[model samples]
Target: MFGAVPALLTYYWCMKMPETARYMALVARNAKQAASDVSKVMQVEIEAEEEKVDKIGTASSNSFGLFTREFAQRHGLHLLGTSVCWFLLDIAYINNLFQKDIFSAIGWLPKAETMNAIHEVYRVAMSQTIIALCGTIPRYWFTVVFIDYIDKFTIQLMGFFFMTVFMFALAIPYDHWLSNSAGFLIMYSLTFFFANFGPNATTFVVPAEIFPEKLRLNCHSISAASGKLVAIVGALGFPYAAQNKDPSKTDADYPPGNGVRNSLFLLGGINCLGIFFTFLVPECKGKSLEEITGEKEEADANDMQQASSTQTFPV
Candidate 1:
C-alpha cells in the first residue's frame, strides 16, 4: 500500500511529458516537432535542424530499414550485446530473488511457525526494507556516482566478477553458512549489492545509449524480453532441481544440494560467462549519444548545433 500508491500516481506525471527529442528527431524524422518539443520542455526557442536532414534525405537513401544488410553490419553486434547481457544478468538476479528463503534462514528473521500470518508479513517487509537500506539502495547510489567516473564497462565487469566470488563463497560452504547466519547474510547481501551496482543498471542504460534512436526502443524491448524469459525459465527449473526426494526430509536440506548446489554453481558460472559477454557492450561513458550510435552522425550533430545555437545557456 505504501509503495504502490506513489508508483501508480507517477504515471500521471509521465503521461504529461512530451515525446522525447530523440524519438521526434530520430524515429519520427520530424526535426521541427523535435525542436519545438525541446523548446517547450526547456522553455526556450530552438532552431529546427530539418534542413540538414532534408538535404541528406536519409529516409530515401536508407530504404533497407532495420533488418537491412547495412543495419546488420552496423548495429547487429550492439543488439546482440545488449540482449545477451540483460538476459544473463536477469536470469541470475531474478533467480536469486525467487529464492527468498535465504533471508528467512538468516539470524534476524524469526521462524515462520512462531509468527502469525500478519506478523510474518510484517517481519518480511521489515527484513526487505533493511536489506534495501543496507545493500540494495546504497549500491544504486554507488553505481550512479561511479558509472560516469569509472565507466559502465568496468562497473559491469567488476560486478559480475564479485558476484561470482560471493556466490561461490556462499555455495562452496553451504552447510557451514547454514548454521552461521551472520556469515550467510553478509555473503548473500554482497551479491545483491553487486547485482545492482553492476550489470543490472548497466543493462538498461547501455541499450538506450548504444543503439540508434530509430531502433533504440525495439532493441531495449527485445533485450528486456529476453531477460524476462530466461528469468522465468530459471525460476521454474531451479526449484524442481532442488526439490526433496526423501519423504522424511524437510524442504531446507532437500537439495542436500549436490543437486541444489547445482543452481548456485550454475548462477556463479553464468556470472563468469557474463564477464566475457560484457566485452561486447562498448563503453559509452564520457561520449555523446551521437558518438556511440554513429548513425547519421553528421545530421545528428547538425540537429544539436542548430538547437544549441538558438537556445540560450546559463552563464
Candidate 2:
C-alpha cells in the first residue's frame, strides 16, 4: 500500500508529460506535435518541419532495427557496456541483503535473538537510517552537483575503484573491524557513498544519453532490467553464500559456507569487474544526443537546412 502511492504519483506525472521532441518527430513521424511540445517547454515559437522529418525518417541508415547488422556494428559495444555495468553494479546487492549480519558481526546492532520483535525492528531501522543519512543521501546530491563538472565516465570509474577498495578493506581485515565498531561503520558507509556517487548514478544516465532517440527507451529498459535481474539473484544467493562456516554460528536449516568475510571479498571482486566494463561505455558529457548517437551525421548527409534541423529539435 505504501509503495503504491509513489507508483501512482509517478504514473500520473508521466502521463501528463509530453513525449520527447526527438521521439515525436523521428520515430512517430509527428513533426507538428514535436514542435508544439518543444515550443511550450522552451517558451519560444517553433514551426513544424514535416518535410524534414520525412527526409530523416526515409534515410535507409536511420531505419535500421535494433537487432539488425547495422545496429550491431554501431551500438553493440555500447549495449554490452551498459548492460554489463548495470549487471555488475547490482551484484553489490549482496551488501544490502547481508548488512544486518555485517552490523551484528561488528557489534553495531545487537544480534536478532537478543531483542524482541519490536526492539529488533527499532534497532534495524535506526541503523539503516544512520547509514542512509551518513552515506546514501549525501552521495546522491554529490552526483547531482558534480556529474556535469566531472563527467560520467570519470565519476563511475572513480566510484567503482573506491567501492572495490573499501569492500576489500572491510573483508581482508574482517576481524580487526569486529573489534572497532566505529571504524567498521565508517568503512561500511564509505562503500555506500561511492556506490551511489559512482556507477549507480552514471549507469542510469549513460544509457539514456548514449542511445539513439528512437532506441533510447528500449536500451535504457534493457540496461535497467539487467540490473534488476542481478539484484534478485544476489538477494536469493548471497545469504547462503555468506553463512558462517562454523556450524554453531550458521542460521537454522542453512548450511555452513564461506561467511561474510569471503562474501565481501566476492563483492569487492564484482566492483572490480564493474571498473573494467566502465571503459566500454563512451563518455557522453558535453555532447548533444544527436552527436553521441550519430544522428547529426545522418541529418548532415541529407543536406538538411539549418531551419529544418532547428525545427526538429534534434536533442
Candidate 3:
C-alpha cells in the first residue's frame, strides 16, 4: 500500500511529460512539436527546422528499418557490447538477493531458525542497510562526481576489475573470513560498491547515446531487457549453486552443491568477462548525440550528394 502511493504519484507526473524532442523531431517527423518542447524547457525562442527534418526523413541512408542490413552494419557490435555487459552485470548483481544465505554460511548472520519472523526480518534488513551505507550509496555519488571527468569506459573497467579482485579476495580464503566476519563484510561490501560505480551505470547510458535517434529506444529497450532476463536466471539459480556441498552444512530441504566459495569465484569470473565487453561500447563524453551516432552527418551528406548528381544546369 505504501508502494502504491509512490507509483500513483509517479504515474501522474509521467502522464504530463512530453515525448522527447529527439523522438518528436526525428521519428515522429514533427519538427514543430520538437522545437516547441525544447523552447518551453530552455525558455528560448527556437524555430522549427522543417526543411532539415524533411531532408533527413527523405534520405534513404536514414530511413532504413530497424532489422535491416544497414542497422546491423552500423550498430551490431555496439548492441552486442551493451547487451553482454548488462547481462553479466545482472548475473553478478543478483547475488545480493541471496545475501541471507551467504551471510549465514559465513557465520556473519544467524540461521533463520534461531529467530522469530519479526526478528529475522529486522536482522536481514539491518545487514542490507549496512551494505548499502558502506558500499552502494557512496559509490553512486563517486560515479556521479567523476563520470564526466574520467569517462564511462574507464570507470566501468575499473569497477569490474575491482569487483573481480574483491570477489576473488573473499572466495580464495573463504575459511579465514568465516572466523573474521568484519573482514568478510568489508570485502562483500566492495563488490556492491564497484558494481554501481562501473558497468551498471555505463550500460544504461551508452545504449541511449550510441544508436541513431530513430532506433535508439529499441536498442536501449533490448539492452535493458537482456539485463532483466539474466537477473531472473541468476535469482533462481544462485541459491542452488551456493548451497553447501557437505550434507551436514546444507539447509533443510535443499540439496548440497558447490558452496559459497565456488559461487563467489563464479561471480568473480563473470565480472572479469564484463571487462572485455566494456571495450565494445564507445566513449560519448563531450560529444553531441548526432556526432556519436553519425546520423545527421551521414544523412545530410548522402542527401546533398544525391541532389548534386540529379541536378540539371541551363544549357
Candidate 4:
C-alpha cells in the first residue's frame, strides 16, 4: 500500500501539466491556437497572436542558455572537474565525519557517555564552526593587521601536507597511551581545521569563477553533486573498513594502519590530492571572474602567436 503512494502522487502531478505550445506550433504548425493556449496557461499576453508564430520569437528567448550546443562541451568539462573534486572532497570529509564514532570503539571515550556523545558531536560540529569563524575573522586579521598575506595555494598546500603526514602517523601503532593516540586525534582536528580554511572553501569558488557566465550553474551543480558522490563513497566504505580492522594487531595490518589511522591517512591524502589538483586550475586571485577566464584565452592566443612566429622561412 505504501509503495503505491508514489505512483498515485505522480499521476496527480501529471494531470496538472499544461500542453506544450512548442510541440503544437512546430508539430501541428498552428501558431494562433498555440499562442492562445499558452497565453491562458501562462497568464501572459504574448504580443502577437499568429498562426505561424515561432516559439523562439516569443519574449522568453534565454540568451547564453546552459547546455546549448555551443556551451555544453567546454562548459561540461569545466563543471565536471569541479564536480569531481567536490565529490571526492565531500566524500572524504563526511565519511570521516560520521565514522568518528569509531573513536569510541577504539576506547577513546569521554568521562560520561552522554556527555561524551554530546561533546563528541559538539567537537565535530564546532570544529567546522571554529574554522569558519577563523576564516571569516582571522583572514582579515592575518592579511591586514599582521601583514601575513597567505595566498590560496599556500593555504591549500599546507592542509594537504599536514593531512598526508598525520595520515601516515596514524598508520603507526599506538597501543599504549604514552604512544600518543590523543596526539593523533589532535593532528586530525588541526587538519580538518586547515581544510576548511583552504581547499574546502576555495575549490568551489575557483571553478565557479573560472567558467563562463553561461556555464556557471551547470558547473556549480556538477561540482556540488560530485562532492556528494565522494561523501557517499566514503560513508559506505569507511564503516566496512572500521569493522574489519583488528585493533589488536599492529596498525599496518589495516589499510593505513588502524581503522582510525587509516581514515586519517585517506583524508590526508585526499586533501593533498585536492591541493595538487588545484595546480591544474587557473589561479584567479585579485582578478574579476571575467578577467580570470579571459586570461586563459589571452594565453592561448599568445601561444599561437609564438608558434606562428617560430615557423621556419623557406630558404
Q: TM-scores across all candidates? A: 0.81, 0.92, 0.93, 0.55
* TM-score, cand. 2: 0.92
| lDDT (C-alpha, whole model) for all candidates | 0.76, 0.88, 0.88, 0.56
**Tens-digit lDDT string for candidate 2 (1-315):** 898999999999999988889889989999999999999999999999899888876666468888989888998899999999999999984578777777777888876678998998888888888888989999989988999999899999999999999999999989999899999889889999999999989998999999877788889999999999988988888888888889988777888878889999999999999999999999988998878888778778656566666675536
lDDT of 4: 0.56
lDDT of 3: 0.88
Pairing residues by index, what is the TM-score of model 4?
A: 0.55
What clash count goes with each model? 0, 0, 0, 8
Clashing pairs in 4: 32-51, 83-223, 86-227, 87-226, 87-227, 91-230, 91-231, 251-257
Which candidate would rank higher by TM-score, 1 or 2?
2
With a 3 Å backbone cut-off (N, CA, C), the pairs that clash in candidate 2 are none
Worst 10 residues of 4 by lDDT: 54-63
Off by over 4 Å in 3: 299-315
Error of 1 at 228 (Å): 1.5
Better of 1 and 2 by lDDT: 2
lDDT of 2 at 82: 95
Candidate 3's displacement at residue 199, Å, is 1.4
Q: List candidate 4 segments past 4 Å from native.
A: 1-80, 95-99, 110-149, 173-179, 244-258, 295-315
